[model samples]
Target: MVADAPLRLSDTNACVDAVIERVGKNITLGLPLGLGKPVRFVNALYQRAKDDPSINLHIVTALSLLAPRGSSSLEKRFMGPFAERLYGRIPELAYARDVSANRLPDNVKVSEFFFKAGSFLNNVDQQRNYVCTNYTHAVRDLMALGVNVIGQMIAPGDGSGQVSLSSNPDLSLDLLPLMREREAEGTPVAVIGELNENLPFMGQHAAIAETSFDVLLEHQPSDYPLFSAPQMAVSPADHLIGFYASTLLRDGGTLQVGIGSLGAALVHSTIMRHKQNDDWNAVFDRLRVADRFPVATEDGGTEPFREGLYGCSEMMVDGFYYLLDAGVLTRVVYDHAGLQTLINQGDISQQVSLDTLDVLRREKLIDSPMRARDVRWLTRFGIFRDTVEFKGGRLRVGEQSLDADLDNADSREAIRTLALGDRLTGGVVMHGGFYVGPESFYQALRDLSDEDRQRICMTSVNYINHLYDHAFGTQRLKAAQRVHSRFINSAMMYTLSGAAVSDGLDDGRVVSGVGGQYNFVAMAHELPDARSILTLRSTRQSGGEAVSNIVFSYGHCTIPRHLRDIVVTEYGIADLRGQPDEQVYLRLIRIADSRFQQDLLKQAQKAGKVAPDFTLPADWCNNTPDAVRQAVTRTGDEELFPAFPFGRDFTDEELTLGKALQTLKAATSTRRGKLVTLWQALREKDEDGRYAALLQRMGLENPRGLKARLDRRLVIHGLRKLDTPSDTGSKET
Candidate 1:
């Protein structure tokens, strides 16, 4: 590649041909994990590699967002039409299709750093080829394995003649500079970028020059919409967990949240606290938040946010947007150390004006003999224009020049009035490494004004995930801005000893990679005023059975017991930090579901971790899902605890059908239930027109063959069961 090479604009096929011509056979391709992969370009490459086996292909990526294809007949009947309606006009993912069908060519190999939800559960090839690494270190590990070509999807910048990495600057921002360095040293590396108008034009480090890529592909901005994960519904159990977690949040603190139903629930509860404080307090009173969990009161605030919050997350999900719109994410932190220190000490607000300058001078935060670096810092913050120059005790802006003598009243007055203006008013409300949300989220980001867009800084994962001691001179500033930080994440299972298993199973099969959960856990302990809060449901449904998530012990642990801080379930909150083994075991059991509490206590006693005569309190026996629902339902406002608080893609009818289908699937999961369901289905009748539309929607309207008739009968019986209001025992597995 030549230095300052002109970016060649070409079609997808031409771009792939150029790449193939350059790298020839045995090409090692690198792409971002999620929404960043260029769909058309990757599809063309996959087709080319498939046609010619001589051209060996090694694809490296993770989290390929593909529409779900059901593995069973019943699942297929329900999901086929649902996915078609949900994902309109989005092109079929080629690599995902081939992998799902187990039809990859002999010369093509796919390696992933992370797997999509249950995508590799039974696939031997993908399981064996998985690469386990953290999100912040994925690029380093891939490059060490000699990944030579990189491609990604990007959005057009705002009239800057540049492009934005948009949702996936996580690894590319750190990898691009290194790729350029290698090219400069006579090593050929190809960086391909494709422009899609639907992606949001993010600011900060996500914006890059057009020349950063060797080849570029452009299509109509409306030709493709950004791929997104549909928002899941928040159950009553999820809402209760959120209610407990909300009491543990400080007013003027930093927040970190992930993408899931739990994260959505947390955002909902926080919004309620800020917008409807009386209702929130009522719910808190019913739950006994202060009485049962005194640590929440000691560390967190119950009153509404007067100072607001700032967000520092590895992935910016749509929940943050909802928080921002509700005015709960209004706290701003600056990038300069002096300003951050003042803000941390409550000496100055986010508004930067002459009053701020006066406060700085009165506090002696700045001196008269200003250093050159200080002048540059001031310029960077827009305190002075780019034309301003500092040299040997003098500052010049445009045609005006002033001495750096702070003691001189004239010089001080001139500097304060002229150099410090209202241009440096805004500060960042959030700093995120990358973002991927619903289609509405992308539209919200794209419609933001330049000023609002800058407030949500998109940068590298290193800054958001860990404290970099060698981050030039900004480490202290970063640390100061992160005071009273709370990193909230989700886990799958947690042991009585406080060890958490989030990313894998005991059999050593990978469910998901260790992506940034460990990073936040470590950082929570490393920071003085930070706490890591991990949330999980007290029980999970598996194979038609309800299993307790709080186990006696787990074989594998993603986060060790030593790093435990706070864990929340629907029942209550557990503060395990620095607690003894017996105390930790008891606390964990206290928050478990009532059905499993006795069994957990017995297991703890057997292991000698707790006393033999120990028993759970009678007051804590109300830790059931039914109790959670009744408490929220008694508020007389059903909308307060909705499935999707912000918005949803599915229609009301679709949601109803989906729920009925889920109940049916769960009913037929066991052998005895299957036989009983079959017997009931044979005697049932759908003579009424109530379920006609649903049957047509599921493609079982007119049954012809014996198999189709049997499927329809079973579906009809399941639908009747769903209509029965008394049946609440079934859960989706």
Candidate 2:
């Protein structure tokens, strides 16, 4: 029987009951990765599974957004208050709680295709159960593994009652038709949807028929907003990395960026190049971008963009809005191959007018004898309206008619001047798979006029992640539009051989899954002019000790050394594509942190990956974090490198406390540091009352116990450290 019109359930329990009735016991459930999970329904289902052992549950999903619960007293004291303030009213994830506590029942098996970065690093069960797959193939792989039930959160419908996939149309759109097919075959596939009014109702493929789902759940939308990824503070090192990556992007090129501090920094730099050219150019000169990377000048350009860029990303981040607002993302490429080619070659602008038609005709892109199909193609590009029709050998638009036989001189002139008319504008600045941004980003999308919304096409991940079209012919329109594509992704560690380890540890524990990084890397190599730019911080602090992220070799690789194209760090960029093993090693070491470079070079030399005769340059030796800060500050504009470029969720006071708490946590990571911090704190004076509210926020205003007093002292020490300027300067040691 055809799936009945969506049956609205009263509560989450009712929804669970309906799911049980539909799919029965021993069911395999599928959920969207993140943001699109129906929290209430998932919690109820998990509860039911706990009560009923016979109902074996295999939950296939990824990126469970769990609240941070500190492991120790000090950690708890700091994180508890911070989480409460930053994540107000956002419901705790029941599944994540079970996984974190190892309280999951034996009958229920939770397998994730992706982890919320570093969330499952310590969880043995999650690490062993992690599914290795790309983002574009997630749904397909899950279906092949027999996921009988699929559920997701959605935005409420408009007047016609058409609900939208909203925050996550990522894989839902791809899975819906498959579910429908299964339902038709009497296999009992259930598509569950819950309406959350807080989600912005997106257009395009995001909108779906009301009857598409087998069961629908709705309630008075929560007063709280959707879960937002708090904006990360951009450091000077992050700015340097962004500055290097920005220099590699050519004008009128395609860009694919992920969501993070690096993305925000990159957008800031791109905007500066467009709006504040003098300042941007001056910074480039200071960095010696043209001299250091001569390949950048050949592959990219140092000049400010005369023709702006077009965005094509799997995730439409908040920074895209900032880029759009600053007029840096104004390159609009159409879906048609001919039109895109003309735009790429600078033969035609996005503004389609009579003059552009004349140019197309002069270039022989348009035929003199325009056929009926040609008229239809022109109409699709907004060159002609629906009121215009080509009948016989004439163009009929309302009462006015013009001859289409351009072979006749007068007819050709009339067709160019009058037939096309002045109404000419059709192109998209970006083609995104799905979007999850801050409240401001959502508001911007919600407030857009229908016409404006059309310019930001929201499609499926399959198109953005892959070049070959599975649905259409092999020669897809998307493949043609993607020109000089730069796929910028981040990695946790990289080997000397250019191998990347983005998701898992060398010991087999997963930090995060291979989302779309591999897919982009593969695509970069496939496309002739495209390049994958992997951005990584040279070092990270672990347990109060600094560790180099660039290693001699790694046990497991996400993007193998063979696929490596461009690797960038705060110090510099390493163009590793097709380079010898020794050259790749030397280039990566050159861009590594100064403290770690000698050690890395020694390791590489010991392994015979680099020549022993090679020596580091004197100037390049100053690749310290302090050096990066000094270089960035030399511009003398504090506003140029604000922590959060777009916007931040935390208040000014919260940000201040957060930074202090972070410092305290860093200091307390080691016993010796903790003792030193306490001693320094006890010797200091707190007469200014600057940390009064901060102490109160951390429950350290009035110390009642020994631990509380120590914690208070730690905070005080951290604050004092922040107040004092570092004496390290640009020294390597």
Q: Give the CA lDDT, 0 to 100, for residue 366 in model 1.
A: 56
lDDT of 1 by residue, 1-733 (tens): 6337545665788888878766667678889878899998888888989989888888999888887768667678877876887676788779878887788898888999888756788888888889988887887887886777889998876666689988888888888877777777776778888888888888777888888888888777435877878888888888888878888889999999988889999999999999999988888887778898998898887788889999999989898988888999988878777788887887766545656656766776655566677677667776655667787678887778888666677977887766665556447899888777888888888788877888898888877887873432356777887888899999999999999999889998888778899999888888878889999999987877789999998899999999998999988899998899999999999999999999999999999999998778898787887787786678768888888887887776567677876776677779987788778889877898678887887688898898888878777777787777677453421
Clashes of each: 0, 0
Q: Candidate 2 on 339-456: residue-level lDDT in tens?
A: 7777667676656565676667787766657768868878878776656788877788777778776567787666666666454456788777767666678788778787767677
lDDT of 1: 0.82
Model 1: per-residue Cα lDDT at residue 679:
85
Q: How far does residue 557 in candidate 1 sit from its true spot (Å)?
A: 1.2
Q: Which stretches of candidate 2 lie over 4 Å from their true place?
A: 1-4, 221-224, 353-373, 390-394, 409-418, 421-426, 472-476, 675-690, 724-733
| Weakest ten-residue segment in model 2 by summed lDDT | 724-733
Whole-model lDDT values for every prediction:
0.82, 0.80
